[model samples]
Target: MIVVTTPTGDIGHQLVEKLLESGASVRVIVRDPSRLSDSIRNRVEIVSGSHADANVVNQAFEGADAVFWLVPADSKADSVTAAYVDFSKPAAQALKACGVKRVVSVSALGRTTPLANQAGYVTASLAMDDLIAATGVNFRALTMPSFMDNTLMQAAVIKAQGTFFSPIDGDLKLPSCATRDIAAVATRLLLDESWTGQEEVAVLGPENISFNDMADIMSDVLGRPIRFQQIPLDAYKARFLQFGYSEAMAHGMTDMADAKNRGLDLGVERSADNTTPTSFRQWCETTLRPAILD
Candidate 1:
């Protein structure tokens, strides 16, 4: 059995669907079983609690051959590091105690970049990877740049105002993968047990596309004049604070965006092996468009 965390999240949900289709025995640790569809609930063993809870992971990991790990975002956390690394400490320990041999985790790109230490949430994610590696479980950190699915977050703005906002420069092209592509890669890794040792699986998308390009794509896809607005770093942090993030947590979000605008996310070059199949436009059509319409 493979233990999956965050199984109801965007990518996790897709990964669970793929694993189910593959006829694999799957188990999930979830905070709310009700969030799971009736079909999913009937198919998999469910541990009903946050995976950050040691008890939940310990119970879920028992007899599991591999695990899909993801630290769900906690917007109200006091610090980004606490949200990522500290929150994952229990689950990492449980992986070893439960004798799980393999783990595939969702992580970030920019390991070799100078900003790794200062990239806020990205820095915390990388640190979480190191902690997981310390457990000696065969680990694959499926690293990715900005997610195209993030567009869904601003869907209401796009629909109402015909625009979206970001701290990153609109003209600066950077790799961004769709969450579905990331899930596809994760599903492939979790199903295959032949791979061992700790490594980063870079799931960059098909190409590097800029926010300006995204606007153009959105305009075409939605048949409306959508625009990309670059908000100031201070404004970005303020926005997070408005969302109830603590001061430190708000700074972390802005710092991560600043690092990305400076090209830290592009530290890892895209290639045939690392790049996944989804493009920004394809994501716009499949994911973003439906959300805006809704």
Candidate 2:
């Protein structure tokens, strides 16, 4: 059995569907089973609880062969470490106790970069990877840059004002990916049992494109002029705080943005093996266009 966590999330839900399509026996740890569609709930073995709970994970991991692990973002987390590493502590223990054979986890890029230690959430995520790796399970950490679907967060604003905002330099080109590609890669890894040992799989997308370039694609795809606005890093943190995020979590986000701006994600060179298929234009057309127009 392959156990999946956060099965209702953007990437997790897609991964679940792909796994089911591949005829994998699936089990999911979810907070609310009702959040799952009737079709999905009927299809998979449901362990209804937070995967972070030791008892829940122990029960979910029992007789499981592999696991898809993702720590849901906690804007109200007291600290970055507590949010990622601490939240994962229970599952790490459960993995050993249950003798799960493999794990595929969602993580951020920047592990090899000099700025990794100062990159806030990225730093914590790398630490979480280490904690899991120490358990000696075959593991793959899907390290990624920003997700293109993140743009949908500003869909309403883009529809009304024709603008989106970020702290990263608009012209500083960097690799970004579609969540569907991430889910596809995760599904492939989870289904294959031959690969062993721990490694970071960098899902760098098809190409590196900047925010300004993305704005151009959005303009063309949505049939309206859209603009990229680089907001102040402090203001970015302030925006998070305004949204009710804890101070530590807000600073963690700000630091992550600052580190990305300073080339944290530039540590890896793109290659065919690590690069995924989706491009900014394709994502803008298929994903962002509908979010803005419809």
**How does each model score on lDDT?**
0.91, 0.95
Return the top candidate by TM-score.
Answer: 2
Error of 1 at 271 (Å): 1.0
lDDT of 2 by residue, 1-294 (tens): 999999999999999999999999999999999999887899999998888799999999999999999999899999999999999999999999999999999999998999999999999999999999999999999999999998888888899999999999999999999999999999999999999999999999998889999999888999989999999999999999999999999999999999999999989989989999999998888888878778
Q: Encode model 1's per-residue lDDT on 1-294: one tens digit a residue.
A: 998999999999999999999999999999989999998999999999988888888999999999999999888887888999999999899988989999999999889898888899999999999999999999999998899988888888899999899999999999999989998999999999899989999999999999999999999999899999999999989988898889988998898899999888888867799988888888888888888875
TM-score of 2: 0.99
In order of appearance, the predictions have TM-scores of 0.98, 0.99
lDDT (C-alpha) at residue 186 in model 1 = 91
Candidate 1 clash total?
0
- What is the lDDT for 83 in model 2? 97
**lDDT at position 127, candidate 1:** 96
Model 2 CA lDDT for position 215 = 91
Query: What global local distance difference test value does model 1 have?
Result: 0.91
- Alpha-carbon runs more than 4 Å astray in model 2: none
Give the per-residue Cα lDDT of candidate 2 at 163.
96
